[model samples]
Target: SVSVLSYAVIFAASTKLDITRKDSIKFICTFAILELVIELLYISYYERKKMISLLKGEK
Candidate 1:
């Protein structure tokens, strides 16, 4: 995924800088978690109509 790739790039860049190892890991993990939550909400919202029709037995 683009997010994973971007996180990889960010981690690599951060490691190259003077930032501590723990901070870089923390930053990457935070972004990854936020992305996951956002994607889940977005998927549920966009698929709400389809889910409702299926629940009602619509074709």
Candidate 2:
């Protein structure tokens, strides 16, 4: 829901600011990739202990 609202705000701002399509695509794609990388890092960091235990075949 936050992501959707962010995208909606970006779209609205782009239209109001008269940004070009190519620039908008580039900006949105970059934002999305950055968000995904951050999310993955957050998950990996928090799950590291569980993952290590699983790799050692623990119950």
* lDDT winner: 1
* Positional deviation of residue 49's Cα in model 1 after best superposition, in angstroms: 3.1
Error of 2 at 41 (Å): 0.5
Query: What lDDT, from 0 to 1, does candidate 2 have?
Result: 0.88
- Clash numbers, per candidate: 0, 0
Cα deviation of 8 in candidate 1 (Å)? 1.3
Model 1: per-residue lDDT, tens digit, 1-59? 88768998999999999989999999888888988999999999879978998999996
Provide TM-scores for the models: 0.70, 0.73
- Give the range of the ten consecutive residues with the poorest summed lDDT in model 1: 1-10
Q: lDDT per model, in order? A: 0.90, 0.88
Question: Model 2, 1-59: lDDT tens per residue?
Answer: 99999988887788777789888888888989999999999999869978888999986
Instruction: Give model 2's TM-score versus the native structure.
Output: 0.73
- Runs in model 1 with CA error above 4 Å? 52-59
